[model samples]
Target: MQITPDTLATLNNGFNAAFLQGFNAIGSQGNQYQQVCMEVSSSHRLENYGWMKDLPGVREWIGPRLINNLEATGYQIVNKDWEHTLGIKRPDIEDDILGVFTLAVQQQGDIVGRHPNELVFAQTLLKGFTTTGFDGQYFFDTDHIGYDVNGAETSWSNAGGGSGSPWFLLDLSRTFMRPLVFQMRRAPEFTPLVSPSDPNVFHMNEFLYGVYARYAAGFGFHQLAYGSKQTLDAAAYAAARTALGTQYRPDGSALAVRGTHLVVGPGNEAAARRILLAERDAAGATNIWQGTAEPLIVPQLG
Candidate 1:
């Protein structure tokens, strides 16, 4: 059934109700966290077991070494220590969905039927939030590899997700991550808006949120940019290209890192596109930067 006004109200009202008070503690007093969009290499992924897989340090098996073991002789891994083999523990971001409702209400003459604006407004909220991961606070987190009881690693690369999931690539090796992976684990169960304080009243469902990236110190400082200028230019594009070229992988080999996507806020989309999609070089005589990357308009970045 379609989401109705009452349903939207249910979700909205619940959101207005009890928020995760404790979760609010994040990014409130401590040092502010910044989400830097960098390139990440899919070649660096290793399906090692445990929380170690999510840890930045464990990603050292990049390049051709990752799957080369299977191609070689007698390649059978044997690790049967299940007594203390902990399950893949994802960061505690909660994904609480409001209860489903019926759109089955037929419009009786002149009653105006379901509120026409309700679904639209609801859609607005969702669309507004779709690219909001660029902002701070408990938002969508990247998924980690799950493991079996025998401590064997499970593939996250299913038709359902895994490799099909969105990610970036760093020209660098596996030891270093170019694009910071937003590790997350959505809550397995959901609670409909129900009142525990008082059974008669509907309570907002709990939407828990928590996300963590690696140490900010890991970020390559020189790679950051903010010229003493106002608008995008070929010089700026050239600098970005040069910086992206420095991304390295775990094998200590240089990766083919290219910006490929110049994501910008709605306000900056035009300017960013002008630099990236220009038919002629914004700086040099050639159209070098043109088509090197597309301008991704993410209004939320604003």
Candidate 2:
């Protein structure tokens, strides 16, 4: 089958449903948790369980499978060496060795060629802000002593002012493996218009407000725009502290907030880094500003 934008969309929808089912199943089973610390490398000649071979059982499999599904829809994967393990220390080890993997997917141009419908959806979502105005009557000053002014002056403002439209930029270089990187312009348009309490807007809020979250969930990768490790680490620490609170206790504890963790599975190292970094920042770690990691691509698949 020739993978095109329409096909990719269909594939993505199916993939998401399937992926969620798999994740929920794994979560309920409790068997996946034990696999986290399993050794990827050989322990010794005598201790040869070959845990690496059981990749399907680990959480990492989620990412790879998603990527494969995207590929099946015609997206090419970009190949890059992303640092999987960092600051990791084994009891007697000195220097930390990193593990790497090559991702698979098609490029954006290729996606456009094959899946133009998908590209259209992406572009439409990527376009500039939608306009809305506040009524002058709503802004009238009650204390004003006007001759016979019925209401206050109304004005139209760019809802998504200062911040541009929310867009998902693709990393052109990592076309095959990591094809999509979303750029959410922090604009009014991006903000949820409906009040959380309003029943009429509840569903709207749930759908529109979820663009970023859905994007993050859909794409199994993140990007750290701020280049330096220290900046990233600092941001991570601060977020963790804020979420957990200064005083740690067994009870009344908040959710743990930390920097991004690798999407344990396979494919496209650079894209993985982007995904992790994005997740870390999205979780409220803003000290490390997203910088020149421009057009970061996120693979549509796992």
Candidate 3:
């Protein structure tokens, strides 16, 4: 192939196609964040999430309807610009070694597709202990205050105190609401700067392939998740489940947050599998905790 106007356009289109192919493939298969996070489309640079914790329970209508003031303030998730770029030297294209660059661009797309997983697991989950949620407390804290159904102030916990490898138990039954929020202002877009007159191409003597998006991840409902740093064993797992199941709504009603998924890093994969999959325990006794929750082994958490 010769360096011509027509050929440059063709190359750009080809790379874009490759990127889309790679993106669609991994985006469907490799994404795990979607299973745990409630994806919210963002139309602005930031979104207020204070209303997320306004758990208003349905009440019996007698004479007049009770109005639960849901005017919450303060909690917000600000979208941030994220990008990835790949450079293809002119010499590589001239030598017809386009295969490597094509794969690289595809891998770039793979990265784009997996970006949410990184944000949710690597960044948000790992930082939950320190990060504040809508209630102005750590997402995984021992002193989360709320009003019970009886209009009494109550304090509940979603964290198990320990100093070991961290693991999580989450209630994924609520599709519209989740333990975490993935706010997307823009989906990743692939752009190729292959025009010969472009400054980057002219000065650097290389074509630039870039992927850009705007998004943010935040804690949604603390009651929907429980994080523990204790040892991953039957005792600890059972305790975590009890904590999640006993959560109460602000209206003082039972939240009924079941532990649907047990999330752990690679370090706890075997233990998690044993707790959720093994039919029998190491003592050769029936494992009562078997089939309790699906185990999710996230590499990012490792």
**Every model's TM-score:** 0.34, 0.15, 0.96
lDDT of 3 by residue, 1-302 (tens): 68898888889898999898888888443789999999999999899976765565687889988887777758999999999999888878878889888898888888888888999999998899999888889999999885565757778788898988899999999999899999999999888888889888799999899999999998888888999999999999999998888766666777788999999999999999999999999999999999999999888988
Give candidate 2's error at residue 171 in angstroms.
24
RMSD of each: 18.8, 27.4, 1.5
Could you give me the TM-score of model 2 versus the true structure? 0.15
Predicted structure 3, TM vs. truth: 0.96
Candidate 2 lDDT (Cα, 0 to 1): 0.24
Quote the lDDT for 85 in model 1: 10
* Candidate 1: count of backbone clashes, pairs at least 3 residues apart or interchain: 22
Q: How many backbone overlaps does candidate 3 show?
A: 5
lDDT per residue, candidate 1, 115-182, as tens digits?
11121122221232122212211122122232333334442211111221121212223333333331
Tens digit of lDDT per residue, candidate 2, span 69-108? 1112221112211111111122111121212100111121
Assess the local accuracy of residue 261 in candidate 3 as a C-alpha lDDT between 0 and 100.
Answer: 96
lDDT of 2 at 284: 66
Highest-TM-score candidate: 3
Worst 10 residues of 1 by lDDT: 81-90
Error of 2 at 125 (Å): 13
Candidate 3 residue spans exceeding 4 A from truth: 27-29, 146-151
